[model samples]
Target: MVKLNKKYLKPLKNFYVIGLITFVIWMLFFDAHSWLLHNDLNKDIEALEDEKKYYKNEMKKDKKAIRELSTDEGVEKVARETYYMKKHDEEIYIIEYEDSLLKSKKDE
Candidate 1:
């Protein structure tokens, strides 16, 4: 047989204690503004913040490329490498390995 103490059981039997416990349970699990919903919304905010940082970094890289392309030498270099452009007398010989050929085709 277990001995139950009246001191501990008194608070549990009180109306105020019961109402407080029910309120806490309702807010944590059943309310429209529940703890679980707030947690999920916080996770979504973190994911969007990460994406925003990634896009800002990509934008900086694009701005740097735009500045470089504003010069004739940079434009010529990109054209020769990316588009395989050449002067009338200049013949460009591009050697592609097996792996490089596969990657190039994948990019196209």
Candidate 2:
């Protein structure tokens, strides 16, 4: 048989205090909407917010590029740099160093 000492049972004698303790325990662990669940949800919200911020920054950069590309000079510069394009009279020579060549393959 288990014994309930007077010191231990004193707080349990208060119905309101016992209820408050039980409610706290249940809310923290056992409820469908629990403290742990809320914590995980809050973490997910933070990650999504960070991702949203990153995408917003990328969109701003793209918008700036679009504005620049509105000019013929910008269009030719982007084409020459990105697509390795050249005027009919110009010769394009791509020089790849050994260090740059050995920078690990992409399809791992």
Candidate 3:
């Protein structure tokens, strides 16, 4: 048993070696900029990149819609539907569905 203990504890008896080992362990696991923090920062970067891609696609779609709305007919159609605009002597009826009303009620 004494021989086994001496063999296992021989390396730890050197103060310089023990201090180096402790410093390495502390830097790897307990330092501010450790491996774990790097991994979390990488995940955050990936999530932000995905969000940037999604917003870019949405911006492209919005630009296309805006280009379409530059025409006279598109403007008139959008105005009539979105803002309930009507021509002179024309009556517009807005029909609200029950399901939409129920969904909005549930949201509230």
List runs of model 2 lying over 4 Å from the truth: 1-4, 30-33, 104-108
> What TM-score would each prediction reach against the true structure?
0.79, 0.74, 0.71
Best by lDDT: 1
Tens-digit lDDT track for model 1 on 28-103? 9999999999999999999999999999999999999999899999999999999999999999999889999899
Error of 1 at 5 (Å): 8.8
Compared with the true structure, the alpha-carbon lDDT of candidate 3 equals 0.94
How do the residues 21-65 of candidate 2 rate in per-residue lDDT, one tens digit apiece?
Answer: 999999999999999999999999999999999999999999999
With candidate 2 superimposed using the best TM-score fit, by how many Å does residue 36's alpha carbon deviate from the native?
2.7
Clash count for candidate 1 is 0
Candidate 1: which pairs clash? Answer: none
Overall lDDT per candidate, in order of appearance: 0.95, 0.92, 0.94
- Rank order (by lDDT, best first): 1, 3, 2
Instruction: Tell me the alpha-carbon RMSD of every candidate.
Output: 3.2, 3.2, 2.9
Regarding lDDT, does 2 or 3 come out ahead?
Answer: 3
User: What residue runs in model 3 are displaced by over 4 Å at the alpha carbon?
Assistant: 1-7, 14-20, 29-33
